[model samples]
Target: MMKNWLAAGAIALTAGMTTTVAQAQSTMIPGENVGLATGAPLPEGIYAINTFIYRSQDTAAADTAINIPILVWATPFVPFGGRIEFVVAPPTVFTFSRVAGGRDTSINVGTFVGGLWAFDLGGNVGVSFLFGSYLNELNAGRGGGLNILASNTYRAGAAISYTGDGYNLTANLTYQFYDTPGRFDGPNGIPAFFGPVGISDALNIDLTATKKFGKFEIGAVGYGTVNLDPNILVFPAGLGVAPGRLGRGGRFALGGLIGYDFGPFSVQAYVARDVVTTGPRGVESTDGFFRIVAPLYTPAAAPAPMPAPLVRKY
Candidate 1:
């Protein structure tokens, strides 16, 4: 009788502890490709699709860049189960001209991203690695339709995440590299690097936080980067192909997302604005980036009960 009472007391203690853990809230980052810690019970054979799009307008000659990225994720609900996330974006299409009549006048297309892999580290801490490449440039001539960057590149990164009590926090480091310099094909004799390739191997560190209250969730992100190999903002469309003339490259963004989750599915809209920019031209509109994410898939349905109910009312 004493052992039974002791066991019952321990069970109550554990339940109280878990309840306390659930009462503390958290936040998540905004963006499709980036990992947002999911604090729910991991479901087996779960598949989800996400779409992210961002458009930034800058005062630079290239003026604007629109990025449309899609992602597909699959996870099996084992204790140490794994998850895979990847982007399915076509090349980005845009125009650039340093001078009004310099005449590189043509549309250009950049490459798409490959798949990325993530492994759950238990307790809401997930780690991920990239298994993909980005094109250097693509042909955007008369017959061109969404060409990729020719100087394809590769990337890898690591992240630590924690999700509990309606709150989520994530810190990550990403390394991106391209083998070639100022090598890209553009429209009508226009050089691929006409604008900012923003390339040249760099390490990016980012932090994100999110909190959920009832049906509404809100969050913010902080990002920083260090150029391992500093080179001029390579623009294939330039005349002298000058290096070191371009301004420094570093940036900070402040953004938030407000959304509601219904059962196993949810939808969110977000806006991120650059508070500080390290582009060659200081705070040029050409580099002002903003993105929106939408749902690409609905979750699975609840399972049906067995033939008989577990408990009889009689």
Candidate 2:
């Protein structure tokens, strides 16, 4: 049947594209910490963060390199009782053994303006909503696969968290609308099989559960993405490829995180592996990452009142 053929083609196309864009486009977003919700905005303050991501794979000869340094500032409250935040992340990437060319490194930047609304329901439960966009930044090169900067896109999401005596649970869902970045149209280029393929919208989800032990917290994190549209439509009107395909670009991963809090600063380390595939198949990636966050400026904590001097009854 025609449907079966389209499904087959979609899988093949996704496999090919995976090697090309694996690094530049990912299920994870910058400024988002493992086991943390993207929709949960930070308290009013300026913050600086460094995220180092190291990834390894079996199929390709080269590994992926990603380093992101970011600065975020959030306002106390906005007109609608929500917080407005801005983020700037400059990421450096290195792609190994690329197909279009060879190996290369590129530096890119991602900027976002977002609003977050968080409300407490009851019993230590809270929910949040986030809406933002990644404005014009450098798109990934055709061959390189280790880019961490998001392609030009808009995203919105919501999150919910529940805290108990010594444990916490958090989950979030987000949707992305990608802008069409034209494909390389040349001999042995991507356009031959599918001309100017337009990317479908995607949905991303993450969940985390942690148990707190004084200043140290340990948690498990899981995340994945699914393309909403079933097919990659051909653009520019000349490619022979049809519009129907299975769109098997979905991917899932699981990881663990350990974090330590230091009053005004925090550090977290995480390790993750692809659950569905190894290599040359579904999304193949094994990544270890760490993040450091510190407050740039914040109001000093109110000092405790002097203990009432014991009254001498005599």
TM-score per prediction, in order, is 0.61, 0.71
Off by over 4 Å in 2: 1-33, 37-41, 78-81, 96-104, 137-151, 187-195, 233-246, 277-281, 301-314
Task: Please report the TM-score between candidate 1 and the true structure.
Answer: 0.61
- Please report, in order, the local distance difference test score of every candidate based on alpha carbons: 0.40, 0.52
Worst 10 residues of 2 by lDDT: 7-16
- Candidate 2 lands at a TM-score of 0.71
Off by over 4 Å in 1: 1-35, 38-58, 61-63, 73-81, 84-87, 94-113, 135-148, 182-199, 233-244, 262-265, 284-314
Question: Model 1 Cα displacement at 229 (Å)?
Answer: 1.6
Name the best candidate (by TM-score): 2
RMSD per model, one decimal: 13.0, 10.7
Model 2, 1-314: lDDT tens digits are: 11111111100000001222322233234214444434334556676677677766756666665666766666666545545655555455555554556655443434444545655465756566666655534444232222212246566777776665655577777777656553544322222333343555666666777777877878898866666765544233454433344344566679898877776666778788778631123446777778766767755777999999888876
